[model samples]
Target: MSNYSYPKLFLFCIGGTGSRVLKALTFLMAAGVDIKASQIIPIIIDPDRANGDVTRTIEILNKYRDVRSKLEFDRNKFFNAEFQTLNSLDVATGEGKEVGSTTAEGFRFGIDGTKEGRFKDFIAFDKLQGANRALLSALFTEENLDAELKAGFKGNPHMGSVVLNRFSESEDFNFFASRFSQNDRVFIVSSIFGGTGAAGFPLLVKNIRSPRTSLRNPEWIKNARLGAITVKPYFGVKQVDDSKINSGTFISKTKAALEYYHSNITGNNSLNALYYLGDTLTLDYNYNEGEMGQKNMAHLIEFLGAMAVIDFMGLEDHSLVTEDSKAINPIYKEYGLNGDVKTVTVKNLGRQTRNRVFKPLTQYTYSYLYWSRNLSSFPSNQPWTKGFDDSFLTSQFFDDDLRQFNRRYEEWLNEMGLNERGLKLFRLDMGHGLLHQVIEGIKHRKKGLFAKERWSFSEFEGYLNSVDGKVRATALPALFMELFYMATEKIFDDRIPNSN
Candidate 1:
C-alpha cells in the first residue's frame, strides 16, 4: 500500500508567504509530484491576502479560466488540488461585543496593533475595566485555533475570535496516527519571518504530532514535518518593521515555539526536522516597480518546497536571511519622526542605534515609576541573539562580530537564569543534522538539488567534510548539557524571575 492518504498532499500557504508558496506548489507539478486539478488546497491567511489587489489577482485568474492556475499538480495520479477561500477578519461582533467602544468598527489590521488581545478582553478592559488575566482570558486556546483552521475552516466570523482564542486557551495542537502510511513525507512551506510563522507554525506542528497524543504509535508525530522555512532577505520595502515589532513582544512565545520542535532526535528523528532557504539581495527590487519580480519569485520558492514533499524528505536551509530577524525595519524605531524614512534613517543611524539596538539597558529600564518620569526615553526588551548560537557560529563562519553578539546574548541568558530546558528551546537552529538530513535524503533519492540545475551526488560526496567539522551540530548537545548549569546557577542565585 502506498503511504499517501488518498495519494494527495496538502500544503497550506498561509499569510505573507502565499506568493512563494504557490510558486513552490507549481514546481512540484513540473517535477512530477502527482498533483491534480482537485487535490491541492490553496489557503491564504494573511490580512493582506484579503485586500483588493490579491482578490483582484485571483479574480482575474479565475475569471479568465485560461491564464493558467497558480499552483501545481502532484506526482501521484491520485493526488488532487483546489483553490480555497482566503480567510477574513470578522469585524462586526468579533470585537464590538467584547469591548464596548465609542466607535464600533473592526478592520483586519486590528487597531494598528499594540494593545493586542481578544475582543472579550479588549471589551473587558476598555468597557468592563477588567484585570490582566481577564484580558488574557479573552485570547483563545492555541488548540482551538489550530483545529479550526487546519480543518480547512475559516475562523470565527467576528473579532476573528479563533486567533484571540488561541492565545488565552492553553489547549494546543495534537498530532495523531497516520491516516496514511509511514513513508509519506509531510512537508510544510512556511515563513519564519512573520506572525503566522512565529505563532501558527509551532501550533500547527504541535497539533499534527504533539508530544502528547493518544495514538498507539507514540512515534506518530515523530519526524513527520522535516521543517522547511522560506527565509527572505531584507527587501527594504518598508521603513519600520511593525510585524517584527509585533513579534518582538512575543519573544518568549517565539522561544516556546522553537522549543516544542527543536530537539535532539539523533536517528530517524522523523517529524521533528526543519531547513531554511533564503534570497538575500532583494535590494534589486524597486519598492514601486518590483511587484512583478516579487510575486514571481514568491511563486517559485513555494512550488519548489511543495515538490520537495512529493519527491524527497529534506529542506533547503540558507544564511542570507534569518528566522530571527524578519529582515524588515523595526517599528519601535519610528515613534520619534514624522514617519519620513530619510529623516528616520538619519536619526536612527546617528543617535538611536546605541540605545535601541542593544537595550534592557539598565536595571531601571522597566521601572514604571521612572518610566512615568522619562516618558520620552525608549526602553526596549533586551537584545537576544536568537537562532545564531556561539560555539556553532564560531566554528562555522567564525565571524568575530557574531561571536561578540552571541557572547552578549549568553550573558543575558546567564543573568536570566535560562536553564537547560529553557536553553533547549533554542537549540533547533541552522546546524549540521538539519542540513545533513535534507542533503543525505536527496542523495538517496537521486534527485537534483534544483530539479535539474546541477548539484549531483558526487559533487556533495565530501560536502560535510568542507565545514569546520559540523561546528553547529556539535553545539546543540553542548547547549543542552550546559543549559542546566546556567539554569541551576540562577536557581542558586535566585535571580530567576517567575515565568507567568
Candidate 2:
C-alpha cells in the first residue's frame, strides 16, 4: 500500500440498533482495532426523542471525543480516528449556522402541523378530493392514518415511509452533501425488522445515489463507495397488553423486507457491498415500542455487524466501483463461526476474524481489568504513575473519566456474554489471577514456573517501566495506554493461540 492519507468514512446509523452497534464500534476503535479510514462521521436517524439506547450512545460518543482531544497523536494508533456530526461539520467548514440539534434531540424532518394533532389532520385528509381520499383509505387503515405523529411510527414501516421520505430536503442533508468529497465513502447500518430502520435505509440510500440539481456535489455523492449492513431479527419480545410491537411478526416482516430489497436494492445495484447477519438462538426482551423501556442488552450479532463495517472499509476502491462509476459485481457477506458452540470463545471464531479482533480485544480488556482490580498496589516511584499529587493515575483523569469508561466497557462485554450465543471471552467476576483468565483454556498452556509467576502486579509494573525508553514520552493518557499495550502484548504472547 502507498503512504497516502486514508479517506473519511461517513457512517449513517439508521435507528436504535444502528446507534447501539455504533457504540460497540467506537469501543473497538478505541482499543486499537484497525479500520482503514482517516476519520469517521456518524449520523444517527431516529424519531424517538426519548430513546434510552440512542441517548446513552450519544453520551458515550461525547465522552470519547473529550478524552481523545487531550491525547497526543504523533504515532498513536489507538483513539486517533476523528468523529464529527453534521452540525459540527457545518460549523467547521463555515457553511452556515448549526443545521440541527444534537444527536440526543433525534433526527427528523420538521412536520409543520403535527405536534398536537392526529396524522390525518396533519395530512389534511379532509381537504383531499374524493378519489384521492378513497385511494389513501385503501392503502392505510383507520388506526394507521389517525395515529399521533409525535413519538414515532410505532413499529409501522408504512407510516415511517411517508414521514422519512422528506429527509433529502432537510437542511442536515444539504450540509452533509456540501462536506462530502469524492474520496470519502459511506456505510449504513439498519435493522430490517423495525419501523424507522426498515423504511429509512432504502430511502437514505436512494437519496444519496439520486441525481440532485440543488446540491453542490451530487455526482460525487452518487458514485461514492457505498456499503451497508441490514440486520435480520435476532431477538424477540414478550407480548404486552397494549403494545404496538409484536415479536411474532418479526419473521413475516423480515421476509417482506427481503423481497423488497431483492426487487429494488440488490437487483438495481444500489449498494456496492451488503452484509446480512441474524441468529436462530435469540433471547426474548421486554416489549417496548420506544423510549426508556427499549434499552437492550448488548449482543454478539451487533459486534459482528460492526466488524462488517471494518471489513467494508478494508476493501479496495476498485473492488467496489467500476470505471463507469457503477457497482462492480457487488460483494455480499455473512458472518459465521468455525464450530458449533453455545459459548463462543477466541478458539471458536474463524481464523481471519479471530486474527483481526481477538488479540486487540483481549489486550484492552485485560489491561482494564488489571487496573480496576490492582491499581493501588503499584509502587508510587514508577515512571508511568509517579508523583504524589500530580500523577495521572491518582488524579481525576483516571478516577473520573477512564475508570468510568472502563467499567462501562466491562459491562458491555459481560452483557454480551450473558446473552444468546454468548461471547465468553473474559472472566469479569474474578479479582485475583484475572490476567491468566482472560481467555478460556489459557491457563492450561504448557509454560515454565517463571511464566506462571510473572502474572503479578510487580511484573506488570516492571513491564511498564521497561518500555519508558522505547516509546515517545508524552501526556499521561498516551503513556498509560502505551504501557498497557506493551505489557499485555508481552505477557500474553506465549499463551495466546497463533493466527492460522
Candidate 3:
C-alpha cells in the first residue's frame, strides 16, 4: 500500500460540508489510514472563495503535503498517501501542451464570474425587456435576485445551478480531465441541502458523464469508477433574522433534492456508488451566509462520510460495473453505529469502523501527546536523543510545519469533541489519566498480582528508545517521526489487549 505504482484518485470536494469532510479525510490520511490510492488530487470546488472551512482545509492539505514531501513512505505510514492539486499536474504532459492559465493557489477550482456582484447583475436582469423579465421575477424572489454571490448562492440552489452550469468550460476542470488516466477513480463529496453542493453535485456528475463536453479523456471519465457521498442535514444553523440561511427549510430542501436525484442521478445510473449520511442529533451552529464566518464545528458524520471515501477506494473493480453507461450493480450505502449515544467513542463505532480507525488514530494521538508535551524537555542521556542535538528542535520541519500541523490536529480533536453528538475518541484532558486513560473505553493491560503497572509515557519512551536504533530514514525529521510511529505501534499492541 505504501508503493507509488498505484492509481491516482481525483477527489472533488464541493461545498462547505465538502471542505469540512475533506478536512476529516486529511486527518485520516495523517494517521496513516489505509487509502489505496498512490496519489490523491483534491479539487476543492466552492464559489465562496473566502469560506472559512475551505481556507482551513486548504491549509491543512498544504501542510500535510509539505510534511509528507520530507518523508519517504518506507516504514512510517504517516502521510503515506500523496496529495497534489490540479494545477500542480500541468507538467505531466510530455508534448509541452499546457493545461491552462488559471491563477488558483493550487487547491481550489475557481469558477469564472462567481467572484462578481449580485445575482441580478450576473443574470443581466436590467437588460431583459417584457416577458423575459417577468418570467425571471416569477422564478426568483426579490431577496434572491438581490442576494450577493461574492459569498455564495446564499442557500439558494437555483442561483448556484445557473452560475455553476459553465463549470465544464473552466480551465480547472479541463485540467482535471486532461490529467485523468486509466484506472483513476473519482469521488465527490457534497451536501444535499445546501446552495453550492446541492446544485453542483448533479451538474458536475452530468458533465463527467456527458459526451458532448470539450474535455480530454471523455470516454475514460464517463466510465470511470465514480462514487459520491451526498451528505444530508446533519447540522443546523441558529436562526438569525438577517441571515438568509434557515435550518427550518433543510429537510424540505433535502426532500426536493432527493426527488430530483432519484429520477436523474440514481435513476439514470449517473454514479457507480452512492452514499448517504445524516444525523438526527443536530447541532445548531452560528449562522453565517457562506462567508469566512461559515466555519462549523467538526462532526462525527463528516468523519464517517470520509470513511465512505476510503471504503469506495477499497472496493473491487468488479463490484462496481457499468454497461451501456448504466450501473450493473449500483451500490447504495449508509453508516450505522453500534449504539445511539450523544457522546460517541471507539466502542460506539461499528465493528468495521473500529477495526479500521481505532489503532491508527490512537497511535497518532500518542505520538502527538509525547512530542507536544515532552520532546523539548527530553533528557540528554536518552538513547533516542543521542545523535539528535538541541538544534534539531529548531529545524523548519519541526519548528514550523510539524508544530503548526500538530496544533491543527489538536484543534480538530477539540472541535469534534465539542460538537453536538460529540466524538470523544480521545480524552484531551490528559491530566486525568494520561496514556492509560487517553482513548475512551480502552483499558491498558496490567501485569503482576497487584495489577498496578499501567502503560505510561515512560513506557512509551522506552519503546521509542528501542525502536530508535532499528528505524532508518533519509532525513532526521523522517527518522524522528518514524521512530515514534513504530514505538507507538509496538507499545500499543503489547500493552493494549484486543488492539487487533
Candidate 4:
C-alpha cells in the first residue's frame, strides 16, 4: 500500500555465535540495508539443547539485552526486539528463554503424527490451541501448493512433531502464511555441523518454499519467505588448544549446503543464498570450539556491503532491468556471470597488520578457481577463507572476542541461506626451488597476488624475487582471498584440484 515492495529478511542460529551473528546482521540491515526501524523482524535460533562452552556462549548472547541495544539504528525509534529461543521439542519462547510448560510467553508447534515417521531425529513441536491453529490457516492461504499437501496438515493441538512435513495441511499452511505476509526473508543462523541447524534448515527451507505444506503448525509462525541466509561454520580442527566439536560437523554440513546451492539455485535462482565464514586462529582458554577476531569485523563489513547491494538493487529506480529478471545489484551481474572478480575491500580501516599470510594466496583464490589434492579442502573449485582481522583483533582472551564476530556473521547467514557454491580458501604451495622445478611441468599458472594497499594479479615464474632485501613470497594473502570468496559463492573446479 506504500507504493513500494519490501524484501523480508529472516535469521536462524545454532549457539553462542549464532545470537551474536543475528545481532550484527540486524545492525547491518538497519544500517546497511536501511530497512525502516518498524519494518524489520529478527529471529534467533539458540541451541538450547547442546552442552559445552559454545552452549554457554550462545546463552549469554541469548540473554544479552545490553548487546542488542548496541546494534540499534536509532535509540529513540527502534523497537528493542529480542530473540525467541527454541527448545528440544522445537518450541520457542518469545524472550529466547527455554520455554517451559508453565510459562505464558512461550509458543509451540502442533505435532500430531510425527511419532509414526521414519526420521530418527524427528522434530517434536510443542502443541498450540485449536482456535489459534484454525486462525492461522484461515489467515494465510495461497494456491501455490497442491491441495493434497495442504490437506495433509493436521491442526491437532497435542502432537509432538519436529518435521513439519509430518503435520496436517491447514495448520502448516497458516503458519508460514502469517510469516510471509509479515516478513519476506528468514535467517536460520546455526552451525551446518550441529544437530539443530542441519536438521532445522532443510525443513525451514521446505516450508517457506512450500508454505502451506509444512508438517507442524506452530502458534506464532508469521509468513512465507522471499529469501533465506545460510551461515557456514568456520573453525580449526580440534587441536591441543581448539576442540573440534562445532567445526567437525559444521565443515561437512557447510559443504553439503554448498553443494545443494550449486545444484539447485542455478542461473537466476542464485540471488537468494549467501555464505559467511569465520577465521582459524582460535582462542587459548575458551577456544574449546568457538573463536572470534578482527576478521569478524571485516566479515561484518562484507555482509554490510552485501546488504547495501541488496538494498540498492531492490530499489526500483536504480536499474534499467525489469523487476522480474535481474537482482538489482549482485556481484555476478557486476562482473558478468563469469566476471572473475578479484576482491572487494572495505577502506577506512585506520589500522594495519604485522603479518598477513593468506593475502596473495586469497587474492589468487578470488581471481581464479582453486586446486588442491586434499578432498577435505573441497579443492578443484575456487578456495576461499574469511578474515583480515581488524585493529580490534587480539590473541589474549581470544575466544570471547572472536565469539562476538562469529555471532555477527552467523546471524547474516541465517537470514540469507546458502543457494549456491562458493569456496572460502585458496592456496598454491610454491615449494622450494627443487619442488618448483618439478611443479613447472604441470603448468601451474599464477592468477593474482594480494599485497598491501591493493589486490593484484601479476605474472610469476614459479620463483620468488627479493626486490628490497625481503622474501616476498607469502601465502597468507592468497588464503584470505580464498576464505572470503568461500563465504560468497562456489569455486571454479578447473582451478581447484581433487583433494588429499
Clash counts for the predictions, in order: 54, 0, 0, 120
Ranking by lDDT: 3, 2, 4, 1
Better of 2 and 3 by lDDT: 3
Q: Give the per-residue lDDT digits (tens) of candidate 1, residues 198-275.
A: 444544444444433343233533433333443333223432432212222233443343454355211213233344
Best by TM-score: 3
TM-score of every prediction relative to native = 0.35, 0.90, 0.96, 0.38
Local accuracy of candidate 4 as per-residue lDDT tens digits, 1-500: 22135543444443334544544444333222234222333333322322232333344444343333333222111113343332212332232223233211122233333323322222211133587645534543332111121121111101111444442242422432334323234444443444444444555554444434232322123222233344444333334552324344545656765676555432344234343443233322223322221112223322332343333324343332213322334222211112222221211111111011122222222322211112123212221212224321232222243235334434333322221122122123333222212211122222345422211122111111111112121343323322323321222222222221
Instruction: Return the clash pairs for model 3, or none.
Output: none
Clashes of 1: 54
**Number of the predicted model whose lDDT against the real structure is largest:** 3
Q: Which window of 10 residues has the lowest lDDT sum in candidate 3?
A: 90-99
C-alpha RMSD of candidate 3:
2.0
Better of 3 and 4 by TM-score: 3
Residue 480 in model 4: lDDT: 30
Expressed as tens digits, the lDDT of each residue in 1-500 for candidate 3 is: 34466668899999999999999999999998888887888888888889999999999998998888898657898887788887776434323234665645678887877777888988899899899999999999999888777788878899889988979877767777778875788999999999999999999989887733466676777787889999999988899878688889999999999999999999998899999999889889988887789888889999998899999988888987766557778899999988899999888998888878888898898898888877775577779876687787888888788888889999999898988788989986776236788888887888547785365677777888888778888588888888888998997787778952
Model 4 lDDT, residue 154, Cα = 17
Better of 3 and 4 by lDDT: 3
